[model samples]
Target: CKTIFPNLFLIIHRNIVSTVNLACPLDLKSIALQARNAEYNPKVLSYSAVIMRIREPRTTALIFSSGKMVCTGAKSEEQSRLAARKYARVVQKLGFPVKFLDFKIQNMVGSCDVCFPIRLEARAVSWIYRMVKPRIVLLIFVSGKVVLTGTVGI
Candidate 1:
């Protein structure tokens, strides 16, 4: 016999990863010096990218010389997009001709607690669960908690 618990889970998005293209090459050294909340250490990553952070959305962005940016630490898709735009705006304000292009939500991570113990041995699949969608993966624990990752959308 099997039991179904309907509406037993409420997932909270923990992190959202997104990418954006600025559509213009960036001068990392200039950005590092001119932009506030920006950090760049050539010895650290060999001048590959500049790391910028914003406090409002609490997100971090990796900005590359090719005008590519990756934003992370947002809790929702909207926040992720907003943060990316904020980053673009910062660069644009720095006198760079930047256009926000190809903003994409690369991955989302969420977790939930069911409030009951799950018997993993009974399922015989161990702890890791892969969804039909190639990008999604779930981790089920005996404590009835689940972590879902790599989802592109809600």
Candidate 2:
């Protein structure tokens, strides 16, 4: 199912078993929620790492090893970056050993096609093709093989 917040989007996986998935925006409020309710913790939780990606014009995804994630849409690069830093801070304050100063940004791009028409004397003749703007993709992975994907607008 999908949940929409003011600046966050969440996709959750619900099964009556032992696996959960969450994705939300890279905002302070949303990040706090995910960090709190993602998994079962007898003691406090510590964050291993935070990763960021610039995937498109307005989309960012963040994944946590606690089986929590945040996907923020319709944001600028600066907003996304700030949100990420804030999230890392929150995790650290929760007594989790968050090492965010070691984070970095990665860029990704790809191509897409659009269709156009060619006209003849009385009928359409051929189709035309074009390339789409490049997209950026960000990935944050904590320890233990958990991958986080974040994207921000260019």
Candidate 3:
């Protein structure tokens, strides 16, 4: 069966590196001291995570001492993985045994460049997406995107 679909356009994209194992606990103090671009200040409630960024993928990583990491700012899947890997490698080089754990896309939220009015039909996409939290959401570019968290079989 052949079907026609509306042209798709992407204005911006965001991906996350769910989680990774640094293998062992990390000393944020050492990491921050080692890199000029890295920073860590627990003085701030929400700023406890060690912040790190790489220029290549242009992403930021929130590395926790518990060996979990959250990477953001990659425009594509490939770029996201590369960015995460770069973060792990950098930490590994810092004498922390880092391991590339389950690195996968958490969600892909995109907005079209077209200004025309468009309808968002969740039911239509349900068969493929299976589940979309909140059922319906209005995306208004303000630095946040929709998150579809679930496990689907291939």
**Between candidates 1 and 2, which one is better according to lDDT?**
1
Top-TM-score structure, candidate number: 1
80 Cα displacement, candidate 1 (Å): 0.9
lDDT of 1 by residue, 62-146 (tens): 9999999999999988999999999999999999999998989988999988777788776653499889866789998887888
Q: Mind giving the per-residue lDDT tens digits that candidate 3 earns over 33-143?
A: 997679899887475689998998888889888878888777777788888888898888988878887776665544433433334455232122344554423343222
Candidate 3's error at 39, in angstroms?
0.3
lDDT of 1 at 118: 87
Model 1 residue pairs with clashes = none
Task: Show the colliding residue pairs in model 3.
Answer: none
Clashes of 3: 0
Worst 10 residues of 2 by lDDT: 11-20
Candidate 1 residue 151 C-alpha distance from true site, Å: 1.7
Q: Write down the lDDT that model 2 would get.
A: 0.35
Q: Model 3 Cα displacement at 121 (Å)?
A: 16
